[model samples]
Target: MEEDSMDYTVFLEAKQLRKQAEDDAKLLSNRLALLRMEEQKALKKIEETRRKAQEIMEARIRNQELLKEKEEKERLKQEEERLKLLEIQNTKAQDRMQREQRVEGCKAKNRYEAKELKEKMQENLEIAERKKQEELEIKTNMKNQIKTQKSLAQEKRRLMNEAKKAQAREELERRIREQEQIRRNYEDSVSRMEQEELELIQRLQNTQLMQQSVYEDLEEAMRS
Candidate 1:
């Protein structure tokens, strides 16, 4: 009866262990599912950020191209105006050359006008160069922004991976501890059972010896 009770208790413990294992498995599965969902969300966010960056880059390129086209048109227009002015000055100089007294004055006027036109052209070139530099800086800033976004995404992924690793490690440690405890409990129960059996055997041997001594004493008394 005692052995049967011990077997029943062991059965209960085994059942409980199985239930605990199932529960732990379920919990791990839930955690994994949640992590996967979060990973998907992070991936989605990264993709969206990339898409926006790509769109912004393309828009900026288009704007830059348009700006270049507008500047080129303006430059051509200025060149045309300068050529017209030069032609007008050449015609007036030719007319003044036909009159000796006025020739020097016309020559002076032409030199001044030429100097002014040259200064205007130089200023326009400087302005164009400044605009080009600004555009370059803007492009550089956009690239840096894209790079920063990429770095952030990578960091987030790295953190997620680390979190998963930590969780897995913790679960492994917990299972190991539980298994060790179960082993210890089993060993203790076995040791206790062995001790009890040894004690019972010793008691039985003592009881048999006492009975034999009593019988011998009875037999001797009858003979007398």
Candidate 2:
């Protein structure tokens, strides 16, 4: 009965050890899965961030060109207004009725000049707008090129991370296999120990039985 109880205890211990190893394996698997998921999420965020940055840079360049063109147009308009005012003031300074005729010619000349100025202003505004549009387009194209380069860099980084993760996963698998082999080795040792203990107990019981039989035979011989 003692031998049977001892074997049962050894079996229970072995079972518990196996359970512990299995739990550890499961935990490692879960950790690996979580890490892989986090890595993927990081890669996706990097891509998105890069794309947004590119778009913002393009917008900024276009805005700058448009602003410069608008300022140029406003400057030309102000200059035209100043010229018109100066011409009007000059005619106002003339006084006599005979001078009125000469002033009238000057007035017609001023009107013609004002008309030319208006046309010139219009032409300048159109030119400025066209130049601004062209500049904006060029800037946008340059921004796109920059963005493409940056995106490629980000992709490279992401791929590197993925490669590292794969390496880690393989390493983890190897470690797990090593651990499993160790567990099996430990289990084999435990089994061998239990067998040895059982054999020792059986040998001790057999020795005790032989001594008891010898004493009984000696007692019978004395009675005879």
Candidate 3:
């Protein structure tokens, strides 16, 4: 009867130890499952970061292309303006040459008329003086027109330079902003990855400790 009682007690103790081991195993399995889930989440986050980085790079490339295109347009516009100024200068030069030729012809005709009208010297003198006055007026008008065109051209050049400076400032500011944003994003990704790695390491350490404790408990039960 005593032996039977001892056997029954031993059996009960063995059954209880088995139940505890089973519970511990189930808990460890659950922890491993949770760790796998966390790992999956970390991987997903890493992939998302990579995608964002790729998008940012593409955007930067596009911005560079746009900048180049704008610069080309500005260059073309400047060239066109230069050509227009040249044309205007050429036209002015032609008009001046024509006016000088007309004045010389008039002078020659006046000389012939004076020689033919020696008896009407006073009348010829008056006509010659009027012609000289008309020539002087034409010269004065031509000088004024040239001065006005020069001033207008200078003003146009100044305006173009100011516009170019403004555009350069804006472009520089935009590039700075983009670089700052990229830097922030990179730092954030690195920080997040480090945090996730630390968490995974800590979870693995905890699992190792739990396994060690379970092994110790099993060993102790066997000894008992």
Candidate 4:
């Protein structure tokens, strides 16, 4: 009975130790599996973060390109506006030059008109003086004619009052002498008056011709 009991006790102790070792090995295997699962989860999270970061960087690059394009368009528009304004300024300068030239032309025309008017006034004054001189000459000629006629009549009356009819031939000769003297004086006076009147008439014709010529010249000049 003692040997059998000792053998059985040893066997029971060995079985209990083997069972404990097997339980410890199973616990180690479970911990290793849990660590592997946690490592996989961490790697998945890191990949997701990297993908989101790449997306953000790409979006920023596209926004930068759009902003650059918009800035370029705005710069071009501003340059166009500046060029348009420069053209307008040049046009205004040209207009001002034309206006100045027109004003200068008007001033020259006014000066010419003033000179022409002054010349016409001088011509009119000369014509008035010539007319007054002609009137004075006519009055002088009429007075001379009246005096000659009065002297002839008084000589004839004196001859009749003497009653010297002895020689009819002498009386007739004396009468003829008186008549010839009066006729010669009257003819000389008429010749002088006729010459002066012809000269006056010629002057008037020349003045009329000059005026007509001036008017024709003015018409041709205006047409030109």
Considering every candidate listed, which one attains the maximal TM-score?
Answer: 3
Regions more than 4 Å wrong, model 1: 1-9, 58-224
What digit string (tens of lDDT, one per residue) describes model 4 on residues 116-215? 9999999999999999999999999889989998998899888876756645545545555555554555555455555655665565556556555555
List model 2 lDDT by residue over 21-58, tens digit each: 66555555555556555555555555555555556667
CA shift at 29, candidate 2, in angstroms? 31
Steric clash pairs (candidate 1): none
Best by lDDT: 3
Residue 126 CA displacement from its true place in model 1, Å: 96
Ranking by lDDT: 3, 1, 2, 4
Top-down TM-score ranking: 3, 1, 2, 4
What TM-score, over all chains together, does every model reach?
A: 0.23, 0.22, 0.24, 0.21
Worst 10 residues of 3 by lDDT: 215-224
User: Whole-model lDDT for model 4 versus the true structure?
Assistant: 0.68
lDDT of 1 by residue, 126-179 (tens): 999999999999999999999999999999999998799678656655665666
Instruction: Between candidates 2 and 4, name the one with more favorable TM-score.
Output: 2
Query: Candidate 2: where are CA atoms >4 Å away?
Result: 1-166, 210-224
TM-score, cand. 1 vs. native: 0.23
